[model samples]
Target: MRTKQDWEWLAAGSEYLAAVAVRELLQEGKSMEAYEGLAFLIESMGKSKKLALRSQLIRLMSHIIKWKCQPERRSSSWAITIDSARTEIEEIQEEVPILNRDYIESVWDKCFVRALREAQMEMGKKKCQIAALDWAEVFEEEYWFEED
Candidate 1:
């Protein structure tokens, strides 16, 4: 039987990681502090450094990481703490005076990658004659071809 627990934790991790990566990309040009897994968690989730954003990122990150977090928990890539995630999210939500194309491009790329990940999962789970979902990070560079 396919227990919910089997896919729950991994799915949560993947979702949060993808979201964080996208949020970081969105805030990349705005703040220098967000270069490495979000700076602090006081204000926002991304690079905003505002208390308001920090709070939200913390909440989202905490929800993603869940209660199973070990005391010295460490992901291969630095795990953005619940606090930091909130701060990062806030930074991304901030309005910039003008449109920054480069930053926008980065965010779009991240979002594209995320969407592909989600699509891959859906494509993998089929009723008749299941197939392997080869959506590993290795082929992340491939452009997604959609029928429209």
Candidate 2:
């Protein structure tokens, strides 16, 4: 029987090990311990998914801010990055339906603040004058790089 600390350490290092331990516990008829470990794994996976979504959101929002703030400096790569991030965020939400618009809305302010700060830093500006982003502006607005 592994201790709580053992499970935490194993999970932190490799989820595979934690999962294996849970399987072993089940085979040994330790149903209660196996259940607890499975629950922990589920919670950890959910946290990871949320973090992934937040990362994509931050990337998308920051690039959009940069595009708006520095139109003169915009390039194809920026447009591509913005597009990619949007696609990835949407894909994540689709795969994990629990992370829907409501979840995005829940973390909007914090993600925006982080994105704003990152954008300002990248653009070498101490402050950016951009306003808060609405869902439509971030996800629905068309941002394309038309080749001439």
Model 2 TM-score (2 dp): 0.92
Residues 34-148, candidate 2: write the lDDT tens digits: 9888877777777888999999999999999998899888889988998899889888888889999999999999999999999999999998889789888799998776655
Tell me how far the alpha carbon of residue 23 in candidate 1 is from the true structure, in angstroms, after superposition: 28
Q: What is the lDDT of candidate 2?
A: 0.88
Off by over 4 Å in 1: 1-45, 48-99, 125-148
Q: State the number of backbone clashes in model 1.
A: 21
Highest lDDT model number: 2
TM, every model: 0.22, 0.92
> Candidate 1: lDDT of 10?
28
Tens digits of lDDT, candidate 1, 22-141: 366556663333332232221123233233333443343332322122323334232344334434553555553222334433443444444344433534422312122222221122
